[model samples]
Target chain A: MKLLELSGIGKRFGGLNALTDVSLHIGRGEIYGLIGPNGAGKTTLFNVITGLYQPDSGEFNFNGKRYRAAKPHVLAGAGIARTFQNIRLFANLTALENVMIGRHVRTRSGVMGSIMNSRAMRLEEKACRDKAGELLNLVGLKKPHQTLAKNLSYGEQRRLEIARALAMEPLLLALDEPAAGMNATETENLKELIEGIRNAGITVLLIEHDVKLIMGLCDRVAVLDYGRKIAEGVPDEVRNDPQVISAYLGVDGE
Target chain B: MPNAHEAGIFKRQRRRILLAAILLVLPFAVDGILGRGWLRIVDFAMLYIMLALGLNIVVGYAGLLDLGYIAFFAVGAYCYALSASPHLALAFPQLFPDGVHLSFLIVLPAAALLAGGMGVLLGAPTLKLRGDYLAIVTLGFGEIIRIFMNNLNAPVNLTNGPQGISRIDPISIAGLSLNATQRIFGITLPSVHLYFYLFLCFAGLVVFVSQRLEKSRIGRAWMAIREDEIAASAMGINTRNLKLLAFAMGAASGGISGTLFAGFQGFVSPESFSLMESVMVLCMVVLGGMGHIYGVILGGLLLALLPELLRHSVLPMQQALFGKTIIDPESLRMLLFGIALILVMLYRPAGLWPSRVRRRELSSDERPDETA
Candidate 1:
């Protein structure tokens, strides 16, 4: 079954059509790749999907329900989690606290319960903290749980962002340029991490400028140019597509 | 584990609990040993703490500069005065010919609600305006409220105009009144001591709520907004609602404190709720730390108490230095305050007690290099 589907998504910023008639689908537990040149509306699409921006015209179905223009927390509560290309972790929070914030949606304690430090709230907080620690461990962050997130290395910060999103217990995870600034070794580690996430039964949607990484990790690739999807298929088919080559690969090759 | 992290957390918690215990017991010791003057100062300091904590929600956590927070304070004071005083019948003779007065309990909530309503009214249009625009708008709103209070006395005698409201009744609880004649336990307590304990309780409640909110989802959303509104919005936080909530909640606190202030002093006037009062509260929040609850409380206490203490000491010292009290110590006190604020801004902009999050943000070097 389709885990996520977008139909007739259109977005505009002033006179600029950042995205128009962009539509895509991902099967359950599949790693779907979105590849486009800069200003090709990949991030804009991500923004619309994550509820940061309401599309001008579109219908999105996630987990078999028609998605509305919900707030980020509402989207998070609905089991959709995402990471930013620029790594937007809560810098002042500890690594564990950063991940724990993601767990806040699942927490049953209301404001009153938290203020009173009720038994259930305390138990839930402890559980959330444990889960946060586990996510940090999964991401191969060797630092103490109390270590501030902003003190981490570049690769670790990216990993921490993923861990934070994972703490929300997402059914589908969106990673935007997870390996943007990483070295080869870091990118390879990220590939392993992405594979592990997929192994844990979560569907993955990724946007990357790195063609090699996209080809290696994605099950299916969707190519976008000038705010429209031009081609989509398996990695080999996307690589061979003439339009994809002319618009994106041609510029990179020169 | 005997690790440094665990040790730090343990030590911090211990210190916090200890400090809270000391503050709780402080009123009793002051009443027993020092007398009413010391207790009066402490009461005033506690009131300032409540105001500071509220302002911190707007300025520190939510990153909205409010230069007219004292308007809410005035609202609270006036609300209490209007409700509790017999003069309500005198001023609004048409509204209540037989005279209408509410119990102190009702007045408290009424003040808070009225002030919160005003906050939303002010925030609705102004929330979209950022930075200096917000500051100026709030300043205008505050002055307008004060001027309106001053002028309203002419036609209707509502706020008693520039003369202000006086002889406002003290709070009463369960058959016992907190008037000058009230006694507690075995000791015959003055109203100042009664108010000192009452303000202490109110300050404690504010601190507790502020601390809890800072660690909750709402708190996180506010902090996120403060760090970067665009990014916070992208994270799915409703920035508009959160900003409004901050303003309303901060206004609510001001209202509560204003009620207490009117009851404690038995008077309300336009001069009492000035721009300088708003700046003083803002200084308390900024001087302590924006988001840190404990820091805000400490900031409030120090800022409120220091000037009063200086006024007491400086005049006597000036008398000794010049052989006559030629210089008014209040002016010198203000000069020292201005100098202190400048130093704090230049040397410790994050405040004397910075919030843990703010401290980490300032100290950490984790920004990804785009050039690299």
Candidate 2:
């Protein structure tokens, strides 16, 4: 079933059109990939979907609820979680603490509970910690309960970001360039982790530069160039499409 | 591992007991040895601790550098001043013929609620701004509040303006006044000593609340926002609401301290809530250790008492060296203070008692790149 539906999405940065008339339909438990050339508004579309940027003209429905100009946190509460293209971890906090922060939307405790040390607060705190620990382990982070996010290796940081997003218990997990800086083995592990996430009944939306990873992993693929969708189909169909070939492999390619 | 954990717990408890004993005896020890004037300084030190802890919630935990925190204190002070004193009687005799004399219990929450609401007012517009921009706005807020307090006398005479409000009622519990000496347990408790104990409880309560916040889920969310707002938001934190909550919580603490200050001094003045006072409180939070409660308390006590210690010693030392006082003591003390601040920043860039995160941040560059 379709979990997220966006129609005629358009975003502009001042005089420049970042994204135009973009439409996407993502189904539950499927790995959907968005691939594009530089400045094709891939990140902008990601930002719009995550509620970082308000789409100038468009509407989106997540889990059957329509939203307009939704704030990032509000979208987060609605079970949509995302990670940055360039990793944005809470560097000073422990890896476990980073995940615990993601549990904020799921948990409920206010200042009064914090001050009075209520029984409910104590129970919630323990549960939050336990959930965070499990997420860290799920992401294969070592010494994550004690080690700071900044101290972790690059690949580890990427995994930790995924873990943090997962801690939100999101219905849709949007990843921006998850395997950007990974070595071959790390990328392989990342692919497996993403598949595992999909298998566990969560929809995955990915923006990637790695065409091979996209072709190999995605159930469906969409290609964008010059702020417009050029072609969209399964990997085999998209790869042979003449418009995609022209935009991707031009007359005189880089 | 369990045995080791239990041993650690035992040691911590023992340390706490010893510290508690020292704290309980501190006012008496200072009174008997250094004099009663020193006890007054100690009492003010306790108040500063409360102020520093409040600011820490905003600056240290949430990473929102607020320079106008003293406005909340002023709000609290003025709230108590207007209600407890006879200023309102002269201004509006119809409403408060004998002056509105509210109990400490009632006025305390009232002041906190007022100041906290004001804090939300400040936080609302500035939520979109961060770093240096946020600081400049808050600085303006502090000055604006002070200017308002200075000018509110003409139209309605609500604040009594620059002259300030005096003869404010002392804090009383069930009818026992803190302003006067009372015989308790066969011991004569001076007014200053009584105030000291009350301030101690207030400071202790601030410390307790701060400690609880430091390790909680809310605290982690705050730190996450401090690290990166976008990431924090994506992590499902309501950044705007949390930032406002920080401001309100911090302001509430400031309000409580203000009520205590007005009660202890029996006076409220615009001069007491100056820009300089705000900066000094921020310094205590930063200089001691921004994120650590104990460090903030230590910073407050040191900064509060250091000037007094210098005032007492600097003159005598100058006189001894020159056979007459040569250099002005006030300027010399400030010069020493400036040098001390420079030295601390130079040697310990994080803070005197840096939190583990801060210490690691400062030292992170030493490790080789391991991203691969």
Per-candidate TM-score against the hidden true structure:
0.90, 0.97
> Among these predicted structures, which one has the highest TM-score?
2
lDDT of 1 by residue, A1-254 (tens): 99889999999999999998988999999999999899899999998888888888989888899887766666767787899988887776778877877776676665577578778877887887788888999999887888777777788888988988898788889999998988898899899989999999999999998899999999999998899999999999999888898887565633
Docking quality tier of model 1: acceptable
Please report, as a residue range, the 10-residue window in candidate 2 chain A with the lowest summed lDDT. A245-254
Candidate 2's C-alpha runs over 4 A off are: A252-254
DockQ class, candidate 2: high
Per-residue lDDT for B1-372 in model 2, tens only?
999999999999999999999988888999999999999988988888899999999999999999999999999999999888888987888989988899998999999999999999998999999999999999999889988988898778888888999999999877888888999999899999999888888788888888898888888888988999989988878899899999998999999999989988899889998998999999998889888887788889899999999889988997888889888878987798789888988998767998877787778758886757
lDDT for each of the candidates?
0.84, 0.90
